[model samples]
Target: MSQSDADAIDEGVLADARAEASVAPVPKGSLWRDRNFLTMWSGQALSQFGAQITELAIPVLAVLLLDATEFEVGVLTAANVAAFLLIGLPAGAWIDRMRKRHVMIWADGVRALALATLPLLWWAGALQMWHVFAVALVMGIATVFFDVSYQSIIPSLVRPGQIAEANGKLQSTYELANIAGPGLGGWLIGVLTAPFAILATVGTYLASLVALMLTRDHEERRAPEDHAPILREIGEGLRFVFTERLLRRIVGYTATGNFFNTLATTLLPIFLLRDLGLSPASMGLIFSLGAIGGFVGAIATPHIVRRIGEARAIPISAIAMSVGAALLPVAALVPALAFPLLVAQSFTASFTVLLYNITQVTFRQRITPPRLLGRMNASVRFVVWGVMPLAALLSGALGTWFGVVPTLWIAAGGELLACLFVVLAPFWTMRELPDAHSASR
Candidate 1:
């Protein structure tokens, strides 16, 4: 077909997708009884657990086996998230043009293969820090595709009403993995060679790949259209996000929260380990205990949204997040209160943050056309997660120059300001999400 004909067909598909986004579908059956959704859920559960194991294992491997310096460790961390900045835009356009399930399965398989190579190299006594970095970078790239497709695929799995419930369950599994994965990683490393420990992670990805392959989703095929130039496609996604008032507000809310929340990741360890003189065991316990908040928040979100509406729930959650951020800095002031304070902050922060996550995810899914969903999600992630590496680097500079406590206070203050963005913006006052898909276009 000619380019004009293709564009016209795409525009028709876009119109249909927007209409679908505006209406709630009647429930066919509970997502629980839907075999396909269960299969998809099982895959996600496995993938999340595997990701957690690798997240811890990679850093531990570098520190223990490769004897990587602190600077190198920082670099490894940055490399893991660098793909969001580098590939986030184009990946979205690519995913939207392809089948989401295929993208997810291939991404998983590629990541598994990349990780499996580590053990072979290790067994040969030729493992190096650069190899680890390269693997991490590869994994990050695969993850970008997986994550974008993952969110975009959800509406296909369940009813619109069920999106919040489904998302809550997914978040619960994710948090459960985060709480348990590190401890599991530590055990595997202690019992087996660091290289061999990776086998479990590799196995999980394989399992996830298998599960996804087995699941049958009857996704409505989009019309065949001429592909736009990659950069223009990316710009289209960015323009959608920025032009829509609701999307613009959400983007601002998330970007601000992530940027200022950097101190929690960057400085919390130092404050707990050096300033407070806590054992690693105690610190781990604190985090694990606090992760319960995430589980609680996820479980509680559907109810919160139902009772108060998503608009109210989000601002309330933001307030909780701001308070959590503020408390981290103050925890150092009272040595006697330090441990308890950190634990409280951890729990409250996780719970509230997840509340924000579940609500926003459901809202976005409801308001965005399926065709633009991947691009919209990618645009949000690029702006939000893009700041993370820079924030990490900035956190180090500030912490070293101004001391940990002061830097944390600055982070906390920034978080409070972040809360205000959501509170004052359209997200807070809008009781219901209108058809933002059409509005954006």
Candidate 2:
């Protein structure tokens, strides 16, 4: 299609979306009554809970059960996120051609099947470190598609005005899962062992699949002949993100934050388990407690945006994130107070990150032309999440070379430095984002 033709299609899509929003029967601020949204939200709730179990179980299995070295654990962490770097750009183009709900359903199915193998292998007494890495890699690949579709589909399920609220609700559910899933998974791990704990994730993912299958959302699918070459489509996404000045700065801040955050996260389990001598249950409790901030942050995001203005909230949250990252090394320094300090770090990081995410994500979804939503999200993730595996591997090497505590100190410094991306930008002077009508074409 010609450039003018593509722009015309984009305008038509946005007009249709506005028309749909105007006629929506549900009252404003009432997503509860939107059955289609509720259906998708329910599926995500189950999926997030299942993911939390795997997040805890897999690392625990590698660390405690297989007695893997710190480098091995880092490699395992890298495997879990490497797909974003590998296929992140192409996945967006693919997702744009299919119904997002269908994409999400398939992703869920892939994850369920992949996780189910862990218990089967363990029961057969054939489970090994490579087996765990392979499963994690597959799950990560599925997750890349699922995550992109999940973000893109929300615009279809709710009115444009409700995007922030929708994202907040979804984020809140994720934090809720963060709070409850680890506690349950850790207890199950202590009892049934880490491999068996993975079975719970398998069950939840299947449940998520059923919920997704029941959801209905408005999606535009391109005919096979209408699709452009994958590389060209990916390039379109990259251009949109890089050329849009507001989005460019936000991506820079987020990509930097994620790099340092993953660096610390890659070794946190080992630090807690080996250095602090915490048991599985205790570690789970700390995670559960720390997630409380995220839960509260999700709930309070709209109010924060309203109070401080959306653009201003970004840098403010970035500043808070730096403070949160700083707490990690302090915990290491004063091991006597390590538990509370670590919990404090989790709380600060989760809360501020949620604040930053809801504000920026809502901005991205609102400003982008409807035709490019999938690619836009994908390009952003490709940059932000792509660095994660590299950071994970670096964390492993750093932890092994300098020890976990000192590595955490380095991670903390990096986190503080990341704030400069947003703090020094124009977002600090603005109060709100551009409306869709006035957004970049």
Candidate 3:
């Protein structure tokens, strides 16, 4: 599809989403009050929290146990995120053709099987770096399917007016998982080896898969005649993301932020272990503090939105993100205050991220058409998340040459530059929600 054709389709889809938002409303209720939404949310939350544990565990395994180089650790991280760059768009296209619930269920099952392999391989004394890479790749691929389907399903499950509230609840659980999962994973790694500690993650995935199976919903059906060639289909998604004024601006801002943030995170473990001289338990404690901040941020989002409005909330969050990034390198200079600095950074970072995510996601859902939700989400994700591997690679190389502390300083500076994106975008000044009826017209 040409760019113009894609734009036309997106406009049409946005019209449909607005139409749905204006009518076909569900009753106002707690997401917990809906059995199906609760089940789905619970399963996804378990899986997401488990993934957070592995995020810390995998790097700790390579560094602490194997004495891997910074470059090698970077490669491992890259392997995990590479799928988002390579498979995200295709997964979105595929998801658009199938039942989203089935996609999520299968994704959970695949991740469970992959995580289970890690512990078994370790027990057999056959675990190698390549095995880790392979598992990372598989899990990353599964995540693409899971995330795309998950986003596509949200509007179907809740009333339009309740989307923000629903998102806040989901973010709160996710933050709680972040609070518990990494802290526990770090503690587990302290007692058990990193490999065995991963068993908890495997168990979490299994629970998620079971939960997905038990949740029931009406299956979605796509139009038979809507199918197109692979290249054309991919082009359509890309076109919608890049050509649409609102989506394009969002994609640019988020992609830029993620690129710099990933750079900082990729070097964080190295900095903590080498420069700050923190133990695994302490590292976990710091991350747990951040998660607590995230939890508070999630709970506070609705109030923040009501007070400042979504438009103001975005820039405020961006400023918070900048401040958090800037504080990371400062932690190195004050070694005695390392943990405290990290706690502060994590708190602000988590809070800012949740607020930004809830606002953007809710706005996108309100504006996007149901039929195009999967592809649109995938397109945005492909652009925003695809930069992670490159960021990891660059950060690793920088750490290898300049040392972790210096690299952190550079990454933080880069993150501060990301604030310019919001300042320059049209979204910065736009605060009011578009009326569903007017948007549809």
* lDDT of every predicted structure (CA atoms): 0.72, 0.79, 0.73
Residue pairs that clash (backbone atoms under 3 angstroms), model 3: none
Q: Supply candidate 3's per-residue lDDT for 173.
A: 70
Per-residue lDDT of model 3, residues 1-441, tens digit only: 000101111223333445665665545456658787788778778887788788888878777766767777777878888998988678766777899888888888898898788878878878778888788889888977786677556666666555555565665576567788778888888898788778878888888889878888665668878877767877877776676665565567678778878777887777787667888778888888876766676689999999888866766777678768878899888888878888898878877787877676666666665656656666776788888899888878887888777887887787677777665665455676553334333
Single out the weakest 10-residue window by summed lDDT for candidate 2.
Answer: 1-10
Best model per TM-score:
2
* Global local distance difference test of model 3: 0.73
* Per-residue accuracy of model 1 over 1-441 as CA lDDT, tens digit each: 000000101222233444554685535346778787788888888888788677656765675678665445556666777898888777767776788899999999999999998888988999988999899889999988887677667666666556655665675577678687656665676677567778778999999999999987667656666676778767777887788776677678778778778644665556665678765456556767777787787679888888888888777887778877777878888888988998898888778877887666656666766667656666777888887767766776776678778888898888888877778866556665566545454
For every model shown, the clashing-pair count is: 0, 0, 0
Better of 2 and 3 by lDDT: 2
Query: How well does each candidate superpose onto the true structure, as a TM-score?
Result: 0.76, 0.85, 0.83
Candidate 2 vs candidate 3: which has greater TM-score? 2
Reference-based TM-score, model 2:
0.85
On a 0 to 1 TM-score scale, where does candidate 3 land against the true structure?
0.83
- Given candidate 3, what's the lDDT at residue 201? 82
Alpha-carbon error at 406 in model 1, in Å? 4.7
Task: Select the stronger candidate by lDDT from 1 and 3.
Answer: 3
RMSD of each: 7.2, 5.9, 5.6
lDDT of 1 at 314: 71
